[model samples]
Structure formats: C-alpha cells, structure tokens
Target: MTNNKTILVVGGTGMLGKPVAQQLKVDGFNVRLLARNPEKAQKLLGDGFEIIKGDVDDPAALRSALTGVDGVHISLKGGPTEADFDHMDHIATRDIAQAAKELGVGRVTILSAYAVSEEKADTPESRSKLKGEAALKSSGVPYTIFRASWFMETLPMFVQGKSISLIGNQIHPLHWIAAEDYARMVSKSYQTDETLNKELYIFGPEAFTMGEAMKIYAEYAGVKVAPISIQMLAVLGALTFNTEWKGMAVLMKHYENWGEDGSPDEANHLLGAPATTLKEWCNKRYSQPVNS
Candidate 1:
C-alpha cells in the first residue's frame, strides 16, 4: 500500500530499530527495513513488512536502499565485537548520509546515546558515534538527533547471584529510560515537522542513582543488592584491557565523572512523555505470573 510517508530503517532488526519501525508502521508510515540478513529480518519482523537486503558496509547497497525513501532512521551501533567486525557506524554513516543527500531524502534522524559531546567522546565507541552524528549534520538533509540516556535493560545485567556489580561508585544518578518509551519518541520524530534540524535529549520518567535504582529491583527480587568494589572494577579493567570487557570499564570511568542527573523535562514535554512509571515497569518485569 502506498503512503504519504516512507521511512527506511537501517539496522531494523536490532533492539531499538525493531520497536521504532513497528511504532512508525503503526502510526501510518510506510516502513522499509534495510537489514544485512533479510531472512533473519523476516523471521523477527514477520510478514507484510518491506525489506531490502543490504549491509551498511557496502556503499552500493546503501545507494540502492535510499532510493525513493522520504526519510531515514539509523539505529546502528559501533562498540565491542561489532565495532571490530564491521566498523559500520563510523564508515557506513557517511556513505548513507551522502546517499540520502544525493537521492534528495528530506529527513534523517539518528538514535544516539547521551553523554556524547565534543570533549567527552573519549572511547573508540563514542568517537565513532560522534562521527556518524557529524555526517548526518553535514549531509544538508533536515535531521533530528535524539541522544538518550541508559536503557532499562542495563539494570538487569547488574544482577549477579545475590549481589550486583555497581560500575564506578554507584553515586552518579542516571536517567534510565525505557526502550519502548524511546521508540515512541523516535516514531513521532518522523511525523512531526517541528523536530526537523534539531538535536534533542531524552531520558526516563525518573532519575535514580545505581544504589537507589537497585533498591527497587532488590525489593522486587526479594534479595539484597550490594555494590561491587572499586578495587574489583579496577582489576577487571586491567584484566580486560585489550578486550571487550574493557569497554564496560571505560563506560564506568565515564560515569564516575558524571556528577549530576540527565534532565528530560524539556524533551519529554515536546514529545509527550511516556506514561510508564519506574515502579510500574518493575512490577511488570519482576512480578510472577498467576497460575492458570
């Protein structure tokens, strides 16, 4: 079916991309997915979804994918094993931006993480993401970039047996936004012309320090949440210096320097803040299912 809006989603099979694409489709936009593996995309995204086969690494494939699309949403990542494997985020972003410009695409919206700035892009991952953001900015297409805080999923990872590993001091407050909430914002970005050519920041409804956040989880899990020592974090950092484990340490180091909370009031006001409360989300996640 032909529609007034056509959006091409790169990395559509990914965690953030899937929800964003689904939300966009639900909002009456014609959504086309550009995935490296069309078979996998089909299996995950199901039928009646338009998908073109392409890897971001190939400029020719990107050119083919950009044709006839009104706008583009990039959900690509450059970190850890994937960064070493493909280098797609840094390299392919430029290619995609160029292709979008040449093809006369109207809008380009990128899903970027918070804490990325001109001075603080210290790690390889941050540097790469910044490059991608820059490429879209200079592409001359009206672009909307939303830098979001940590995801809700990150909380579960801290759970290890009876204790949780608190990266850094657990003192820094972080606004842990839900992926679903962020997806809604992304879907709205394409529909709203006001978002054009602007960079916005988004976060969860509530901001909590790791210690405070863990208390909610611990209460729900019926267990005590305790911090992992700075000494242990240091040891892990040393052991995993040349490996992907080091990346988490790098992130923790960054968090250690972040003293304040991420403000989401303005961004939330503009995009209509997500209705899910932290306690509500926790209850849904941790609560046991009723017996049939």
Candidate 2:
C-alpha cells in the first residue's frame, strides 16, 4: 500500500519529530527528514531514507529539502523570541506553507497544542502554534493538526529532591500524554485518510491533578510526601522559564491549571481509542514493582 511514497519530515531531528520519522519508516513509507545538520539525524540514517540538510526557515534549503515529497510533517518549536510569540509563529509557518505548496506536497500534518485558543492568541507559544495552523490551511494543502497535551516524561520536574512538588491542593486535574503516542499517531495519519483535513486534540486516557501526578510518582518511588501550594506568579515565571530548564518550566505552565480543557474525551475521535488513563499509566509507568 505504501507504493514508496516519499514523506518529508521537517524537524525530524527533534524530540517528537525523530520518533515520528522513525515510526513512519516502521510503517513502510519512504522517509526524508529535514535537519539543520544532516548528521544530527544520525540515528535515522542507513535505513535507505534520505536526510536533506536545511532549516525550516530557510527557503533555498527547504525548496531542495522538499523535492519529490508527497506529504509533509511539521514538528516545529519556536525559539526564544517566541517568548512573546506574535512575530515568530505566522512568519515561519508561512514560509513552510509556501514551500510545501511550491513543492507540490499533497498532505501536511502539523503537530500543534491542545489548549491553544483564540483568546491567548498572543501568548508566544499559543499564538505561534495558531499561526502555524493558519499557514497550513492557507497553503491549500490537505492538513491535519495534532493538538496534544503535556507529555508524561516531564514528570521529573514535579519530583525535585527525589520528592514530587505540589501546587495548591493535590486535587487539581492533570492532562497527560506520552511523546511516543503523538509520534505514532502523526506517522499513522499519513497512511490513513481518517485524520485528513482536520485539527485533532489528542490526550492520554485520564486526567490527574498536579497533586495526583506527584502522589503517583511518590507512591511509585514509595517515599514520604505531602501536598503544598506556591504563589501563582512565581510558579508562572518559573514554568514559563527564561533559563536552562526552560522546556520543563514551559510545560509546567501549561499544566499549572490542568490545562484549558476539562474533558479528556478528545482521544475518542482521531485515534479512536481511549488514551492511557492515570491509573493505567501509574501502574505501567511509575507504580511498577519498584525494581521496574
């Protein structure tokens, strides 16, 4: 069924992009990844796939990178200037969109965010994503946007001093996901039309509060722990981050209030299966046999 279709994976050298690119290869599609340094895609090499050296924002590089590509996968993360987001998102997305169209790419799948809304249309992260989404649509290519929640891996942040931290009561809901799930789904979308021309919100099966997530982590670690609250602005400043651990901090800001969605039903649509629930996640991920 593959017919050796060439799928161009932009940012395939990234945390999510690399996994998605790897999965695409597993599913029998010809993979072409875009990288600033083709060597960075080192792990993805030697599989008969091609790595086109370039940056997403560079036209000459992108034009060459996109040659003969049937579909495009964009997993872009804005830079520091996106801390104010307004100028970065749309412009970069526009560039990518224009390139895809010129290359005659037929389908485009953009990995987006779950809580991104029109109101926060100005937050550097949210706005940038929205712009990316707009760019894809405006480009006139068939598209799919995977709006995802927080990944389960960042659980380490809540666990400082080998103990999980808490904000407010331990009852605030937490929206979670695994990066692998997003990668697989995005890769799968290319092979199936079920996800075509739509913006899908993907999530794990259940919701855990900051307190609940930490509690599970603690229970898994089987250590003494308690819930505590911190000032919102301070937490915001740290979570929104301007330092080395900025990624973790940025993620925390989104989860600071269990995200913007209360219902975890988004997974029922695009993926057609219940996302992994908190209990299931805890048992498999954290609350294992301790030695696990």
Candidate 3:
C-alpha cells in the first residue's frame, strides 16, 4: 500500500459528512467528495478540495471516485423500508468497498450507529449498517467502523409545541455525541494505522437521560419542557405510517423495550481525546442563530 494523500468521502454533503470532509481538508489531505452536484459541493467546501460528480449507488460513479484516492470514508442516512436500506446503506457501501479494494485504496472508514449489533432489536437501518460493515471487512481492505451513540444535533427536532416526545417513561443513560466531535474522530481515524481493522463504539464524554437532555434544551430555547406519554407516542405512531415515520416508530418501540445506554471510555482512550459534553454542545449550538 503506497501512501496517497487523496481521500474520497461518500455522503460528504450530509450533516455529518460535511464536518468530516472539512476536517480532513484542514488536516492537509487532498479531500474529494463524491456527490451528485460537484458545483454545490465545491461551493460548500470552498477552493480547498475537489468534488467528483457521482452517486454511491452507481458502480461507474464509484469506480471513478476511487481513482487516485488513498483512503475512503463512508456515512449514509437511513431510509424507510428494507429495499431502501438495501440500495442505499448496504448495496451502496458494498459497491464503494469493492471499488476501493480493487483500486488498492489503503483504508476505508464507516460511520455506523451503536445499536446496530443488537440482534434482538434489529431494524432495517441496523441490518443495513451491519451489511455495510461486513462488506468492508470481507473486502480484505483495512477498515474502521464507528458505532456511535445519538447525535446531539437531533435534539432540537424533537421539540414540538413545548413538549419533547419520549418512547417510554423509563429513564435510560443516553450517551450523545456532537456531530463535530464525531467528525474529528473520523478524520483522526484516517490519519493513523492504529485504527486499522477496528470496530470502535464511540460516544460523547457525558451521558444523560432523555428527560435530562430535553430539559437542558428547553431551558436554552426558552420553552417549557414536557414529555409525551407512551400512550400518546402510540397514537402518533398510529397516525403517521409513512416510510420515515414508520421507521421511527419501530426504533421508538425498540428503545421502549431496550434503552440507549453506553460508555465512551474506550473510544476516548483510542482517539486520545474526550468528546464534547451535551451541555457544551447545546449551549454553543443554541447560542447561534437557528438554521432555516
């Protein structure tokens, strides 16, 4: 494996992907984004990096993206059905892995969720992520898979009419990491040999229950805090049955049965730095003007 400074980041235009690409560029790597709109990506990334016009699902596009790229970073947002997961998360990642391997790319890193390994509570999203991880592993390409906890950025979206929806009444330890901190971890993973062939369960420096987290956010946003009961959650689940809503319903059911809980000690030890705390992230993010 010869050293090539160029790295290709799939899904680089997404919420999590944007920060990873930015950090890689700042770290002096020749960062290239495989996006549908190269012009838009170039505009977002400024003049520092390149953007290859392509879709991850297109084999030809992936092959072109792999050319002259040393390493590859993959992160995908989940879709609703099994077919959606199959095409986007599983099949797309497999294509990227296969292309990167054939092209002699040195490393491949995947951003996955912490609960993907729980077979008892598997959803289409989790199953798809596992497939993606397996694809990279089976390709014989050195890989790093990050199973991260919830993103702190998603908290605001749950705020509706002064109430935060809860899957259940039980309070569970939720280890929430900021997208920026996660991106930093991903960039660092690409820089060292230490993370090769590793499946890391990464998380935030702090843990909070759903109520505790929502209360903090409500206070910051100057809104009264209240939790939607399990009965109401059931009603909402029944009312909205589309792909996105259906997926959330399934996940919420899983959380009701099992809890979102973890410790970041090992991940922090490996990364050599602590992640941003929930309070810190909320304060910083909320202080700024909310995105339209």
Model 1, residue 123: distance off in Å is 2.0
Residue-level lDDT of model 3, residues 140-258, one tens digit each, is 88899887877888887777775665545646677778888888888888777888998787877777877777777776776656655555655665787545555666666656555
Give the per-residue lDDT of model 1 (tens digit) for 1-292.
Answer: 2358889999888878888888888888888998878888999988767888877777777878889999999888666644652376667777788889999998888887777777777767667777878887888888988888777766777777876666667576777777789888988777678888877888776778878877776777665667666557657767767554566666677766654444566667678886665677777887742221
Ranking of predictions according to lDDT: 3, 1, 2
The model with the greatest TM-score is 3
Pairs of residues clashing in candidate 3: none
- lDDT per residue, candidate 2, 104-142, as tens digits? 888888877776777645446776777778777888878
TM-score of 1: 0.87
**Window of ten residues with lowest summed lDDT in model 2:** 242-251
Show the colliding residue pairs in model 1. Answer: none
Judging by lDDT, tell me the better candidate of 1 and 2: 1
lDDT by candidate, in order shown: 0.76, 0.68, 0.77
What's the lDDT for residue 292 in model 3? 18
lDDT of 3: 0.77
Clashes of each: 0, 7, 0
